[model samples]
Target: MEIQEKKNIYVGVQTTQTRDIRDFFMEIDSYKNILVFAEVGEDKVCDNSLELLGEANRLKNIRNNDSFVIAALVGHNVKKYAPTLFGYGADKVVAFDSPMLEVYRSDLYGEALAGIVRTYHPEIVLVGATALGSELAPTVAAKLRTGLAAHCTALKILDNGQFTQVVPAFGGKVLGDIYIPNHRPQIASIKAGITKKLDYAPKDGVVEDFSCELNGFERMKVTKVEKETETCKSLNEADCIVVGGFGIGSKEEWSKLEELASLLGGANGCTRPVLDAGWVSNEKAMIGTSGVAVRPKAYLGIGVSGAAHHTCGIKDSGLIISINKDENAPIFACSDYKVVADYKKIVPALIEELKARKG
Candidate 1:
């Protein structure tokens, strides 16, 4: 197929949020190209980053190769992986190597990215929803003063030469479609796992290393980097999840919920109130909207009210069994099966039944 070159449409890329915010605006596009921000030395480029490239490649094909994909990296050893990123579909890799970029500080990375975007006006900009990504994407959007969408689950190009950003709203109960109709560049941040990565193919592309001048605002001082200690497997990746809500009644009764989860080879999760009440760690809590979205093999909702926020996260689970005293609870509507009884009485009995079944 003959690849058509798009005279418009450019994508701006930036490192994870730890970099300078202004770096997002440094580019001026003479033609249509997708810019991918390469996070060097981070070892793991976020899954969403590769997903964006894949989508861009797909768009390129749909546009008959009228567009090209360009990757931008800022680090000391960026040249090493230029070939790898190109193989993944980038037509060009722009490198900005420096010691300052080694450690990501939002101020520095943001500045560098912003400068690039301003110099090259891309039609669209994509970033991962990581800690650094969340921080930097919004800042760049704000700086560029353009429309920005967060936590998008899907992205596509409309036939009319516009980008469509789809995300879950009201706690995943509904999908919201967003677009920047009048903006020069529509910006969106995509959640990981929502999209798939494309296979790497052989491609010949140019790798250009350019020296950058870091100014005062571009240099953000770091006082400390405190690492979090209480690490647990993310709920989104769990095989099974047992969630409790206000109906669990008391902190003392949590053990019953934990026991049931253990039997099923699952981990314990909770609603917002339970986590706020200190019954479980925040990481173990499974509330709606604010927590991780999960699609486990089995989800046991104990005493949950089935509010829009709480139920939205678990709707994707393969099996859902809800335990509530009130048959009319909103949660019942979404459950595969429902048990109308007091959790205090039924939980212990259910645990025993599970154990007996195992035996």
Candidate 2:
């Protein structure tokens, strides 16, 4: 069997006694539901899981009854999280409960997820592009022999049940629209905070048990689990954000941004270069096409060069205020209020003014 790739599209050649692309396309309509991985963290469903659920609900609304939204949850004592999942817009939840499945093991979780996909064929599968999801989504996709659009910034469902995945490429310089027409369960691991969390309204939904057999933790040994000490603020839920870019300069100036964020009672975010420069602790604090997408009430970009990739994340923001040294910076075009000045001088003055006004 030969697979031809032309401009990011994969075309499968016919093989003896194998399903061709046409066969898969013909079978596409039969596949129902937009499935999402309801990943549990510390016995609760994470925000990213809910974000995917909300997005899936939108697509299901567009597709109508032809496609329902379902969540595949795997964990020990995780059935309790199903109500939240349903309230967030899942039609049904498949709970895989077992002691061995408590912690995330790639082999066991992948096998169980693959089994669920085989048993109940869904047209689309969504996972949060978190640490676990990054590891698991690819594994499931490989096991099922399907295409996965990783870290997609946006999604659109066509009339024919096809998905157009939007993501950044070439160091966040360009947006790429990816389509996987000849695949079942169009899998994508969307970055956290790209989609809004669904409004909580409890509804009538079924939680069915999904059983998976697992060996006694023999495949992989977990000697110790060390959680990262630093936790970045959730940009998705922030009403205001203070973002820094490459122009922010030095670690000291980055700390000043943090103080500004604190003064505004919001979070501190950064562009890709800031994150790459180790100015921020985690990728969650980075906002761009390749990073987290935020829709804040007020966004203050300090010393930032507004690249297309960075603007894509904050385009949905309500009021944008940009401070830059260059008057001709592209960021000024998007800013509601633009100040041409050295951010190092202006930021300290602004902080003092804000303090004085509050005092």
Each prediction's TM-score versus the true structure? 0.73, 0.87
lDDT of 2 by residue, 193-306 (tens): 678778999998889898755664246866788866657667877899999999988877788888788888899899988888888768778887567778899999998988
Error of 1 at 347 (Å): 3.5
State each model's CA lDDT, in order: 0.70, 0.82
Q: Judging by TM-score against the true structure, name the best candidate.
A: 2
Superposition TM-score, candidate 2 onto the true structure: 0.87
- Candidate 1 per-residue lDDT over residues 90-114, each given as its tens digit: 7777777777877787777777676
Worst 10 residues of 2 by lDDT: 1-10
Off by over 4 Å in 2: 1-29, 216-219, 229-237
Clash count for each candidate, listed in order shown? 49, 0
Instruction: Give residue 233's lDDT in candidate 1 (0 to 100).
Output: 49
